[model samples]
Target: MKGITLLAVSVFSTAFLSFTPLNKKYIIIDAGHGGSDAGAVYGQFSEKDISLNIAKEIHKINKSQDKYEVILTRDADISSSLPDRTILINNLNPEMVISLHVNKSPEKETPKHGFEVFIQNSEGSKKLADKISKKFSAQTIVERNLHILRETKAPAVLVELGFINNTQDRNYMTSEKGQKEIAQKFVEIINEY
Candidate 1:
């Protein structure tokens, strides 16, 4: 009877393992600009710093979850070329890619504000953009032939978080609370996928 019970337990364990789905959705979070490439700058704030902070936060929060696997192109202040980033992204073959950047208008105090989502000419990219844009106020989704968007193997979207030149945007992005809020929102959105 003991042997029969052991065999039954083994069979149950095999069946359970077969039915469990261990596949995690791989996602690439590319932080725009780094090192000398400060991207948009306003006063003491640099786009590179802001983007990396947010990207790291997202990665940190997502690491605790089992459904999604988050990867960042550059986790430090070092500069990484676009081609190199694209190659790594394609090699990983992630399910989705979101590039983070801060926008800057021609004028520092320009009235132009809010986020923008740029996507490639594919339905998958558009769908991803639509989902992301819906969460933010004053978001514009447009088609762009950017190298990252064009070369990536998965549905990709370049999100301009906000204008660095604008006072409201700058204040929000620079603050730690605001960064955490942005990261939390992104994590919530990612979990939906």
Candidate 2:
């Protein structure tokens, strides 16, 4: 009887260890465009590069935290199709997804600036966007039918960090300090989730 009980306990322990704990929340940080798809571009600044940097920064910061598991769609400069990204997101079934990007206005050096948070029609998506926008003191929270937002199974928000064409917006987004601050904001927000 003792031998049988010990064997059963060992099997249960092994099975529990093999599965992910329910207490930890999984979050996906999607770097918008990459490689051939350089999203919004202005001078030397590319949206793909900026978004990737921010995503990596967030992941790095989250590594120290025990309650959350942060994942990135692409860690390098490679183009990933919308469908592929969506599939990954759906498979992970994360608690939330944040897609990072830099925006560009049609006009040269356009004054349009500041961050914009785009969400899907779902209530959870809207709530997530509201939390992020409030953190940045952002005014624009638009409902968009973007591929990433529409296709992802989890609550997701697409954030346009800043306008690349605007001088102030461009400078802030490209600088290391700005990126760190942006990344820090996300870490803080994720803690709430």
Q: Which candidate's TM-score is highest?
A: 2
Per-residue CA lDDT of candidate 1, range 49-129, in tens? 999999999999998988878989889999777877886777566789999999989864455688899999998898889
Clashing pairs in 2: none
Instruction: Please give the range of 10 consecutive residues that has the lowest summed lDDT in model 1.
Output: 5-14
**Each model's TM-score, in the order given?**
0.86, 0.88
Give the poorly placed runs of model 1, Cα more than 4 Å off.
1-24
Model 1 accuracy (lDDT, Cα): 0.86
